[model samples]
Target: MGRQGLMAGYEDLVKKILRIRPELSEEDLERKVEEKLRSSPMLSRLGALLLLADELGALEVSDGSALPFDLSGFTKVSSLVSGLNDVSLSVRVIAVSPLVRLDGRAVLRMKVGDETGKASAVAWEQKAEELATVGLSPGMVITLLHAYTRSGPDGRPEIHLGKNSSVEVVEDTGTLPGVESFFVPISKVSTAGTFDVKGTLLMLSEPMPIQTKSGTVNVVEALLADEDGEAVLVAWRDKVDLLTGTLPGTELMLTDVRFRGGRFQTTVRTCVAKVARERHELSRLMAGSKRLVSDKLLRVLDVVKQPELVTLVVSDGVWVYRLPSRSMVGVEVKEGDAVRLVKGFVSERDGRKAIMTPEFGIKVVTGEDARKAPSVDRRRRLADISEEESDIIVEGVLQTKTPLGAVETRFGKAEKISFWLRDGEATVLCSAWRSKAREIDSMPVGKRVQLRWVRVRRNVFGELEVLVEKDTKVVVLEK
Candidate 1:
């Protein structure tokens, strides 16, 4: 590489650095790079920029590469660099375009993604026919080997496959994330790109058939809205299935969709699935300034008895909610009871969102009226537990463990207990706070117990652990 080649590489490195540290202006980045090269006279400009990127924490694996899936020898879509050869990436097929003659050769274009980001890829000649033969569809995970990267028309890096390249279906991994997991909040979308979104269907238009070169295509338009904002979603061909039979207020998740010309459009690779509306709208209970009118039935998941305040871990079928109060609002509430919070003030405790009610805000619903409340299941398998979920119930045989005792926390020194809960499928570490530590201390070794309303969160070492607090209901069951 000559001076021009070296300068191009330097420019690319500068762009990569700017992408991660957008707060730094281009002139500032160039100035810093110049200063680094001057200090280390022997170091090349690119090497100096790499060191600078490391110093700024821009080159860390903190991006989507931190996902649980196997990323060995695979590059994240967001990390793709133009002018790199023999790149390997594991991504889910987002869309596949029909075979077309490009520059007198058959070409097949696709959109692929992992949890981190999405990218555009093109297959040429033999590879194009091979991909079409394989009938690649949306959601299929595959790895591209010996592919090359080039900047797209929009200046973003894209993958290209030639004669030496190969694509293999990833069959061994079950942890590959679905496209829906990357849903972008409605208010955050501001540019043209492929994105996933979860929102309630506010409006829908009748599908109309349009004649095209290939065949007749059905088109439908829908208005989607979430807590933050709303957007227009347009669907074409089979993607129109999302709009058919869908009613207003029904929550929908659109995956691998494209946003352009101030609207959203669904491609062949787009997947439309109806999301759980009850959970989607639960945020409204805690958000907004207006007082809630309709009584929201909350199923008591766990009850913690304290000296002054009783902490009730509850759920509205989807999201686990916290309620800490000195008074039960003239109602007798227990674990598994269905109650309503009237004019409750949503508050946050130790980073956890909770609701505080006054006078008569807490009311218990029973018998015939309870049937109308959302059904809440406190039972869950250890394997189903994830860091993103909370307020879980698990039944398993406990492994013997003594109380850790007197761990220092922000609050103060608190008694702590640890044990292993093992079911047929998996085993998980269960730890308890001071209020619940005594209960676990008395339990015999290998005893079967059901722990309800236990919180699921990561420990200090970044491992998922079951947290038992005063509200946790631990029932010793017969072995």
Candidate 2:
């Protein structure tokens, strides 16, 4: 049979079921109706709605003599007939807030409107992306079908496109005869307070890997701007790659962006980071590099107490430096001797300056990389020092030796030099910034050295400095 004929036949069957099954339960009647309509592809779209209407008394078979169906305490389904058949209707989209997930799924609320009326739509996960692409603005008219309704917190019926709903965008009519404009400014669009925005990328930063208590996570920061204003956009994990090869002048389109932490920042909830070639120019500047300072080399020992930061290579030409701890990780470095140190800005940590290794493409020459990058001393164990005054003995090969020089400090002038002490577990940054720099400048890398000191100070930045006075001995284990 033809499509129209098939639809008519299903309608007749539905009418018959309502008339003959007045005493049947809503479920039993729905089951029978589904069985009859199963063969009709047209009716399949209405299967759930038909069953729901019959259950809620929305569909009457007998001359409206009191709906045979009981709606009782069940959620009321809104009537779709008003706007469903309006050919003059145009697509209108409303902005929604970021969905907060207590469970595994995120739930976002959006409103779709036409000349007839407005209806709310809920999107989860993948569907959310579809609605986002439609560029749902506050004034765009939208057409949707197969939607279901449920009771909202206010006891009023709320409309939403079901999982199987089909949504469409409708263009506006020139005059929209007899239809009032329900269009609102995009500024007023939001789900709960969050809104959607599209903009251009003005600046971007390379992905920085952070080692958290849970695991390693990559994060990137970018500056996004639109006609309205500018804001910071943050992307997480694999999304960080979006800005990898992108330049500062690139244009970007963002959805489900939000205001966070007193500033407008986009998180990974429903936001998308796409490079817009038409809107902005690709940034030609190479990714920034982070520099590892000699002081930080020692702090890593006090914190992780391992070779975690020793001889780090900038694999992707980008890295991250966390504050306070002055920890450096995930850097791209090539293997070579006399590793070149790149220049970069340093941020203050605990009143001390900490350098970012990746910002200026700076790299530190690992003593191992210096001479075939010596094999990591796996047997060396991390030392724990706690007492204010204690004598301890340590043995390790000198990895690198710095030139001795007089460094002016608050406590008068003193010779300073830095050397890496490796005992198997990890390399420790030993600095004689006050008294050893001149003495150790003559010491070559790879020469085993022994030192005895009674007092030392560990700085807040995790760097270790030796406190030498009159009673300190430095013995050369091997020349």
Candidate 3:
């Protein structure tokens, strides 16, 4: 703007040119400065000086990004700045965000963190294109050699990788200090950065078609979780397909998903998801060993025994589960017996919510035999315990029998017999103790039997109860 300001800018440029080409003598410098000033007509004196020096080949530029990042004598990210010496850094590739392009230049963004601190890394042009060829991913450890730092717009430290600089894959990083993740646990998820999440599909609500500003989108609500915590995931339009294909207790991973509007969810834009074909950790949950209690567990309020399907009711909800073979599940269930449906699919029929499961994914806990027994329904015979009466009076047909011989007992080592019986409605297990084992030398299956005043108790493994003591009347009602 003023003659004095113009002179100051030009003087600064002359000094920079001299620093790069110190061989230039005083006379040569004076002549170069005069020629540059006369040939360029930029308002800023420094602008004209730089323009002339560049065109006249008087300025020397470093071949940046031409050397591999060298870790030799490297330093920490928190220790470098814009004008500081270039140094190498070791960081975890927390996330690789979407690439940005402007004016024909490409820049790839990466959220990198290390034991000491976290920073953003930018790769320009060619370096950005080769990012995929380098096979980088989140949770991976990387080493950036000969890298430099600069203050970002927000005035925070940022890493800049040039042509010569490189990010080499090292190993997967351990838990980073003071660092969060794109694939953080459900409990730790927040509305902050672009991220991913992995969890089991606990429950999926019916897809509700809503009219949005974008268009009509089929929005499906889902509950997701791992061993740690849970979050509600909502999928719109194309992502709605995930609901039908997924099952309860399914292991899955969602990519490019986010947390917004107080919800942990994402649509299928650049986002993707992968699901385990078969149920994983389903047994642990059904057996009550590994419980994700809050929403993962379904408390059975009642059970209905169908020919090949079992309908379970919980509170105000109901599930119609198809059984491949009720044989494996011991179809006999009662009210209050907790049922963990691993791969149940929720659907709607006649405006009512219905659920189904694959034959192999079914597991049940019977109220009568469970270690944690609920009130059994005695009004209905053993076959139907939806009433939850554990009154212990059961008259059923003898289904099978096997002698578990020579079990040590209070009356010395005596014979033990295990048998299954069904009261035309449900099946149960019974054991004949020591002397009572003699009453029926060998139980004739297919015969109707009755036991009076038998003591019922849950066994060690929370399975069948052993009855038929010396005082108990073991009568063969029909053979």
Candidate 4:
């Protein structure tokens, strides 16, 4: 080929790799292809270039005859690299993850690898159910005929099986080789894959309830560390129940854990977790751990989110206890719960108290009970709040709608609105998020508007002011 032809062919190969792994940096692509070319024999330099091009998808498969009969159009996982990104290839099933229901369809995603590299494969609808019918399991050699390829959101190479694809168990006839299994360190885990690793439990967060499309699920996080590094372990649903009795500093071997994007996590079902037999080292390490005194329980008066972290303002109503990151524990508690510092680190910055560790405990109590604790006085009439007091609750009727205004936000700007509220005694300006500003539209002017967990403080100019927090419940009572 001439110089121009060679340049065109090389550019086409680069474009092919970009199609499947678009996130692959240009420098990475150049290095991989150049290395592959160098490993080839010098006598087939020109031939190697042609093969690379055709393998990547530069040349379309010939129509009808002339091509190899039966297996003429098959491709390999390694060549699925570079050209046309998508290729019809056969691979062995390394591990099949448990079927998860999504939108009423049983979706099966699994780890499939070849001699080249590891990749993920997914099947949905009828293809998913056929996985069991074909008796697909760990170390099963399966031929995914007419399967296409795509780049996962995380840039990992993935094989996709659609309605056009078919899966059949192939005998170990030396043609298809089984992929080697290995353990991935916690540091190298970030995307979706089935992996195994062992580490010592450094920290354990309580089960946090989260709402999902399937329903509510409890998520608990455990930090595992060894001499190498630390990895995060998350257990979902009933899986968290398994770790409830497991204490910090225990040794755990997480096998076949489903690690999705964000952090190292583990799901139940197909995953197998084995804890260490003894924990003498763990017991000695926690000997000096700190514990919260029940007498110092701080009543949570309100909740506020500063950026991505939720700050719980706890008090006996006379003093404020600031717990900076209650979200880390994933605990759902509001004004009714009494937050107590537990077995974790605690510190005081300036004049305020701060719970440094994500670990803490909560005690549920009514507003009446909170008021009875020592000097706490949480509820008062709209006109009764004094300038010296803050973090109180009030109930009134929304009198007028405040004009919505825009405020600077992390992404860009956000809207906010305020209104006047009355309780037959006095009035205060109640604010709502711009997205929630229209909530008062359905609220009749005379319809009673009850505000719980509102903040009353003196603004910059030294005037008594009332502020509504994001968690502040604004319920419109009927006439």
Candidate 5:
């Protein structure tokens, strides 16, 4: 090399060192570079300068810039040069594409990035199949060894892995920056594109089946929030499994999501993982005066039945509480019946107090104890029912009943029955699900029954239907 070119490289390195450590004068940096060269003979002037910069912590900031030497043996994403072979990198996976066949051969693509910048990467043949088998997802830190670089379809530098290359999940992720650092805060998301977000899962809805032109697909709606604000997120198909057991207050990291209709939806490239969880003890959540006292004898006021659970509105005479359970169907208690609640605590739900229990911890009160329980009956006329009102009580004769049939719901297969309720000139349809279907199916037509706390809604036919839910109480009045 020409002496002038070598001198220029040394001068540039000295200037970089001076910028980071202004205390080190140009002469001092030259002396350090000479000392490094003296200690390690065979090192060129530029190589010695690079070593000195590493010792001074200046090389770390050489992002997106070409370095004379790679002491760490890993190349930065932004510093990648096309046609370079055996290049190694440590980066976090931001997105991944499904393995596809190109010319009848398998190829997998991924978007990876480091703190420096982002880049596209691909694996072909055996490597692509291996990566697919490893379940590569967003937010995972991986190291690629012996990979080669080439121009991508967009005429930009891209990393490619072949038979000689290797990929492994980094065991110690602390060496690299956290995945959340690359996230665009939830509130600032406005454009429709692939983006990563970090926030707390404030709310999660039950997975529902939606009919599409292709087929029925399962989807879950969730509200994610950060300190700035909240936004909606929808998980579709296989991505719904990522949120299956997660609850509100869980910290989440979502990657490769697409924003549309003012909401973020999980795409084929999207991946979700829980970052952290806020633990709340049951006793701490139920610490209030209106809380339910465990093992207390309570009077049943109403019952609501749904496909997944049953809710009973019970009262301790002074305070009312809603108790819901999936196993409560086994208990055959009705309104005015007294039951002892065991191992249950009161917690606020839907802005109302409720009794939370792991199972049906109810024991029926009988003999003299039942007579001491409080009793109350409230009723609403069927003709006065409106779609806006909920938890309405009404009495009518079962004019027509449908045979019990099994139907598949999100909660699983359950029995269902629809019946026509007639009161004077007013007639309405009522549908019971799960255990309530069996209860209603046993009752003969033309019997007078009172349904308390039933929900009113219009069916698809635009006809008013009284919906019996987990908390609706069905009482048959035999005269």
Candidate 6:
């Protein structure tokens, strides 16, 4: 065959082989070529060029650039150069795995020093895996072989190491260069909203459960006062289990605090708590301060085992009702059973205040002696006067009702149901969401039922609507 025809035939074979196994690396393709050449010695040069093309893969090559080495050298050297990089300069030593996912493919990352400054060099996936095995430790010098530049994720140029690239690690016996370390003072570390602040533990509270996205979360919230005043630190879940019953004044450290409701709170998932004896430098910076109000004292109302909903009359003559769920479980307290709740912030529903339970220390003082508060008279009558003002109790028959099963909520899953009910006064439309919904749905619609903890809200059409939540309970009455 003529030279052009021979070359064309060899290219066709290379394309066919690549199509069969696109994932084949340079060494893999060369192995196949060696086997073919052994069978037909006359086709050795054509096999060599095809092997080189397979190794190069899709990477672009400069014009007139010769192949780095023969097939044997390409395979052996490619294995040796597990990772490769060619950058203007080297910078700080940052771990590379987090930067990219190579799936066992050779990868490399290096900071190369340049005339202007230092920059990062990144090799992705298969190319990265190949370079990784060559021991590209920090401060190691390497020579770039058949390395080329390509655009990276951030739209900037980065090194792309192919089979032709070369890398090496050499020992440096001279005095090591000083590495710069960064530090932030506690005061300067601004936690604008909720954030995690790690410092010496200045004070701690008893272990308690706080409602969170993951259901009931056991937690111990304490004051982590450093040189920059004090911050609320919460140890969640297992951390709470470990820190509970710890000494009050013992030093503690916390991580992964979340700032919410104008205070820092941590959950079982993101928080870590520990007790220590020595004060940290941040704590020293926090010295010489007057006694600030303790978080325990501020959050006292959270721990009180009250019903899911509690009503308090504020000094402004507005009644504020605090509702409990998986969210407001643990808090510290301070004052009165009937103290007025000051309006701080209102929740999504215009009526409830967003004040921390511990902030008011208020208690249920009026109904202390009554074992059974006349729910039918107080709650039901209010429901009758204005459906929007109702907090009703009912004993009625639930007719054939459509059940609303589990509903997805930001907090978690909740079940709901809609039912028609006949009380002495009138037939009403009622709906239950969450646990209560499941309970009501389980009862026979024709059976007599008693419902407690029901709240009435006006729908968009100005009709009274009963909104039943998880805390609402349904009892099947004896006919």
What lDDT score belongs to each candidate, Candidate 1 first?
Answer: 0.70, 0.45, 0.55, 0.58, 0.72, 0.45
1 or 6, which is superior by lDDT? 1
Candidate 2 structure lDDT = 0.45
TM-score list, all predictions:
0.37, 0.34, 0.34, 0.42, 0.43, 0.36
TM-score, structure 3 vs. true? 0.34
| RMSD (CA, Å), each prediction | 23.2, 17.4, 21.6, 15.8, 12.2, 17.1
lDDT score, candidate 3, position 164: 66
lDDT of 5 by residue, 284-360 (tens): 32342232356677898866665555668877766567776666766687877898877554544333456655444
Question: Which tens-of-lDDT digit does each residue in 1-479 have in candidate 4?
Answer: 23354356456555554554567776876665566556632212333444544555444543332311224345656666422333555566655655667779877777665665556677878888767454466565555655667776556556777776666554344555543343455656666676665666756665555544476777766666654555557778766765677766666655557665444566543333334535666654344334222345567666665344566767654665655564433557775576555533333422334443344444445566555644355667888866645346688877887566788877567677767888786987666664466565556677786776667767676766667654566766766
Better of 4 and 5 by TM-score: 5
- Give the residue spans of candidate 1 off by over 4 A: 1-294, 302-311, 334-337, 366-368, 410-412
lDDT of candidate 6 over 247-303, digit per residue (tens)? 534544333345553345554223233334554553463454343222211111112
Worst 10 residues of 3 by lDDT: 316-325
lDDT (tens digit, per residue) of candidate 3 on 185-238: 665676555455666776665554454446566666666656655566767766
Superposed Cα RMSD, model 1: 23.2
Error of 5 at 9 (Å): 22
Q: Once superposed on the true structure, which residue ranges of model 2 sit more than 4 Å away at CA?
A: 1-142, 149-159, 169-193, 211-216, 226-229, 237-248, 267-269, 273-479
Per-residue lDDT for 256-304 in model 2, tens only? 4565542344444333434346432333211221211322221111112
Error of 3 at 345 (Å): 8.3
TM-score of 2: 0.34
Task: Give the clashing pairs for model 4.
Answer: 56-83, 56-84
Better of 2 and 5 by lDDT: 5
Model 5 weakest 10-residue run by lDDT: 281-290
